[model samples]
Target: MKETAYLLQAALISAWWVGLASNGVFFAAFQFDAIPSTAFWAFFAPDVILIAALSTVRAYKQNSAIELVILGAFAYASLYCVNATVLTASGYLPTGLMLLGLAYNGFLCFSDSAFRVSSTSMTWNAIKTLIQTVCIWTMALVIVPYVILDAFDTFALPSMDIWLIIGGLLFACFSLLGLTSAFFMVRDGAGTPLPLDQTNHLVVSGPYHYVRNPMAISGIGQGLAVAIIFQSVPLLIYTALGVLIWQLVVRPIEERDMTRRFGESYVQYCRHVSCWIPTFGRRGT
Candidate 1:
């Protein structure tokens, strides 16, 4: 059963990458108002480079199901970018293809056995996480800024300045860091970052050695970066509120759960690491 699941996942990911590359070529062709066959190769070349780069990273090995999911997500996003760009350029929507791609991607994500738990439990947890992500991101990035802050009229996108570049770099770095932290939970702790499938072991290595909640830092950092890049005060306020809520409500509950699960080992780790601030040179627990 496990081998079958692995094979299915591999096939889905392979299909997703091929679709993504083809879509990129279509996007380039549309942008240039031409459909030269060479455009396909041009787009495919970058995918080859990207795959090679991912291959060099041990975390992205074939056995790492979660890492493969991450790569699949990137491919899915690339397809979306191509679709969106084509639509904007031509003022036409590939609604059927878009829906099909979305359904297929959703199937790939849910069908994979990323957790050791029962299939029903994993599906439930994944659905919960998906809903939570959509809600949180929409509120922070869209609703708060557009509806509440009147961002459409109040703020404009920032010019391509040093601050904008810095914000982009920070967002990219923190996003990767957060994903890496989650990967560690899966690889080292034999679990996930979700509360329902919480890590079994105390993750003291990687970013956790420096700070208690690197994931939260990454979330807040990305939010702040987006706010700065778009010059949206409301988005910045939303980001701050998110951090405050996590610190006040979420962190306490998570710490309690950790203490209950890990007892003295977690307590010792907490004593050594700061909650938010990164403390270099402090010996890890």
Candidate 2:
């Protein structure tokens, strides 16, 4: 059953990547009339970076699920980017900085893959796969309503005159920082890799000092950045949903397993650190 699950995940992820590459090419083929909206540029362009990064890392070893997921994310981003091009032309796309951050992090995910010298125990990482399955569906389901409403916001809902651009830029900067921290933590061995996963270490340093789950926080930040850039109310709602799901549903399960495996040290670390949010105090000072 475990192997079956892994194979299924691998197949799904591979299909996703292939689709992403195909659509990415299609999206690139069409030229935008104006500066692509921040939303479009932020989410769409960096997908290649993510694909390359994940592929490079996976090449070091074979990780079916992780590979598939990285590919799947790129495909999803590609599709989103194609839509962003249309929205940008219509002048409805709201932000760019957030998109830039997304691209930057995507690059980091790839570049960080350059560092792995050996393989280690990634036992019981299947729990993460289960969490991911739930998380992805949750994200999609939560974002759908907003997408529908946003699709017709121009015709049905009144477009707010709020400064979404500023918010989007702020979001992008935050995401960039988060991604940088996450990359460094993994690349530098601040954290160990989850068993069986082909990424990096557990990453309990730098940004991880403040938040036990920097990557998850960064993911939420990225999602929020997208919402702010586009000013998509639905995406905003989904961002909130994503945060809650990650915090409430996902982290607890992973942490329990991690704590059991890592023992008292993991518990001690958890004492000083926050899960989704970063702590400001200096460590061991």
Candidate 3:
């Protein structure tokens, strides 16, 4: 069953890749703008729908931590895609390709099997928390610091496009959303409330009540926001691609893992809450 699940997931992912490659090639050949965003959504939406349809018959085991970490990488790649696309569309050929390559490599590095496994549910969620730690740390220690230093020492507001500024605001909102989930994970232990090597606990605090994968949502939001900030067509496309990839790879893995880890408890949660968005009445308070 596990093998079948893996194979099915793998096949769907491969199809998505093929679709992306085809779209890219078609765009290049025709000298037209390749809206990979639409293509990606179109190609993978079916896979998601199909998987969702079949999940009722047999639940797939998943790894939440692994999926979240990969998602972080997906967010990074999405940023690159949008940025690179913009450069390319703007007629900066070599630079565009370079950014494009960078985005691809970043995603490739993070999407390996080793990086996609969380042995226990607690560990799976903890792994996501750890990723947030890394991201938030980088934002605090590197990106933010650099931005601030540049702003203060140079006496200049960073050269940001209006889109990028918008992206930044979006990122802030999403990052906060992710942090909400992260806090619950930290507070509970791997599954929630603090770091632990052991897997246990089911979190129902902070952002969990509002959504299942707030961190994933935040990561995606940040990616889109960054794409806007960069205003890069490639980046934006990549952002869309990233979301598709997350829906394809990360979400399924987490869902399966959580379902297995929590069983009826998770089943109950699924009934009451959603995987990404909130239930109709439950607001993120």
Clashes in each model (backbone N, CA, C under 3 Å)?
0, 15, 25
> What ranking of all candidate models by lDDT puts the best one first?
1, 3, 2
Say which candidate scores most in lDDT.
1
Candidate 1 lands at a TM-score of: 0.51
True-structure lDDT of candidate 2 = 0.49
lDDT of 1 by residue, 134-198 (tens): 66557555554554333124556579898799889988998788777766655666555665456
Q: RMSD, model 1, all Cα superposed? A: 16.9
Error of 2 at 281 (Å): 2.0
Q: In model 1, which runs have C-alpha deviations exceeding 4 angstroms?
A: 1-152, 155-158
Rate residue 45 of model 1 by lDDT: 44
On a 0 to 100 scale, what is the lDDT of residue 70 in model 2? 64
lDDT of 3 by residue, 1-285 (tens): 332433444454455456556776423431214444454345345433433223322235454443344334445445554565575563233233334434433433343332232244655666666775786657533453333233223223336567657767887888787777776665563443222222366676677886777766776677666555644444455456557656765566556655766688878877777877776586432
lDDT for 34 in candidate 2 is 63
- Residues 1-285, model 2: lDDT tens digits: 222222333343355446445765323323344654353446443544555445555555566665556646755655555565566553222212124324433432343243332233233233443455356535443344344344435224324445466656666776666556635544554333332243334456567667776656666766776666566665676577567544543455556556655678778888888765667874641
By TM-score, the best candidate is: 1
Residue 6 lDDT (model 1): 32
